[model samples]
Target: MFSLPIIALLVAGAQAAVLTLQSPRFTVSSSTGSQLRSEPISLAHASSIPVTLTKDDVLKLTFQVIDKESGKGVQPHQTFLRFYDQNSGEEGIQPIRVTNGGKAKFELNMARPPLSLPPTSDAPLQVSLLIGSSTYSPLALSLFDLIVPASHPVPAHPDEASFHPLPEIHHTFRPEQKLPPRPISALACIAVLAPWIVLLGLWGQVAPRAVHLFSPGIFPFILTLGAFESLLVWYWVDLKLGQVLSYGGVLALVTIFTGKQALSKIGDRRVGRK
Candidate 1:
């Protein structure tokens, strides 16, 4: 009778030992205009999952974790959920304490703050559920891997041109408008070349007398010039005034330091002569 009880306990312990956990399926709830939409998602088809959310849209995801062998919901205390962005490297962990039929829900606010760029549509994010003890065996269920969509879709209009036709123009007999003068201003050209001319003059004047001074300044000058060129390109192409001003401020500091060093070297040469 004692051996039979011990064998029964061993069998019960073997049944409780977890080998793997089932991947959770998700249901997403989103609102489009005045209508609310709910869609089911399978973890097995995570690679093809489409994330369709616009700015200021609210998104909700719900899923449940279960044991692979028993096909039963895993206990809340034995599981935890982790959400992370693969591109931004931002991660958040939540304890799994589901009160409703072993289902856990996560909510996300998709509103973009003022002056902030929207999240990249191509960037991937993941939600995973981990199970089992930290010291021994553990299993991870990749609940969802989805790419966020950045922009809202434009509705197609089949006869838009027909509805909004171009207006007719009338030609007036008047004197020909005077065209602007050809070629850029000479002052503008001088302003552009002035920095380069100054740098070249300083190099010529200081390099022969104090080779050490010139060599040390060369690397910084080149670096500053490179940064300035990059800023110039950014200004012309992107037309971002804030970046241009910030970079110009940094370049100004570097140029001031270079000028001070050059002046000091010239003073040293004068002192030696005297």
Candidate 2:
């Protein structure tokens, strides 16, 4: 058995070996079995004539990966075929399977295009082969330019428009409503308060007797109810409706409690007199 250092050196030397392809060739055929083109691929340069395929045509490629010095077939760790649409800036990589003996074959049928194919345009796709291995150096070869029928445009989603930024809202709000002249505003305010003012002016003539008006229990009920009214007035002038409602709810509870106590006291006093 070799020593550890010697074995490591041998493995490193083996991994540094160069890799190449053997008998790289492609054949284009019709669905009806008639061959349109058949030629061996050159690793030095890509083909000048682009291979064209119609709706039902098929393309078959055959190649074998080998060690450059040993000339023996090698099954690499990874192999891939890349199709790139130069104009569309779209590309796709399709993994290729190499047999244990390093024999590899790929077939492209236009009848059912592979998902790895990029959406194509009028421009030809630049085809390339890439192979990687742990034992040998990686290799890349530009194959041939391929021209196929343009793919149908991808359909848009139903909510595609919702994805885009919305147009800015330029609210055309009514210019701040100008207030009426001060004298007119004052007159309007007076008009609104006119009935109350008149009613207050005639209070002495129409005022009725309220014997329990100042009774301690009854007066508290009246004061709580009055506070409720004041809360409403505040809402009309400065406070928001929600705040007024919240305050009114609390005031209503206080008013109910006071009214109940006043009624209870009156009943007890009446019972005492009877």
| CA-lDDT, candidates in order | 0.59, 0.91
lDDT per residue (tens digit) for residues 97-209 in model 1: 66434556656546642222223445665766666653224656675664455444334497765688767889978988986554556667788889998899999888666
Q: Put down candidate 2 lDDT per residue, 1-274, tens digits, no spaces.
A: 5569888877887769998999999999999999999999999999989999998999999999988998988999989999999987989898888998889999999999999998888899999999998767778899999999999866679798789986788879888988879999899999999998888878867887898899888999989988988887888899998898888888888988999998898898899952
Among residues 3 or more apart in sequence or in different chains, the pairs in candidate 1 whose N, CA or C atoms overlap within 3 Å are: none
Best by TM-score, which number? 2
Error of model 2, residue 236, in angstroms? 46
Tell me how far candidate 1 lies from the true structure as C-alpha RMSD in angstroms. Answer: 29.2
Q: What 10-residue stretch in candidate 2 is worst by lDDT? A: 1-10
In model 2, state the lDDT of residue 197.
81
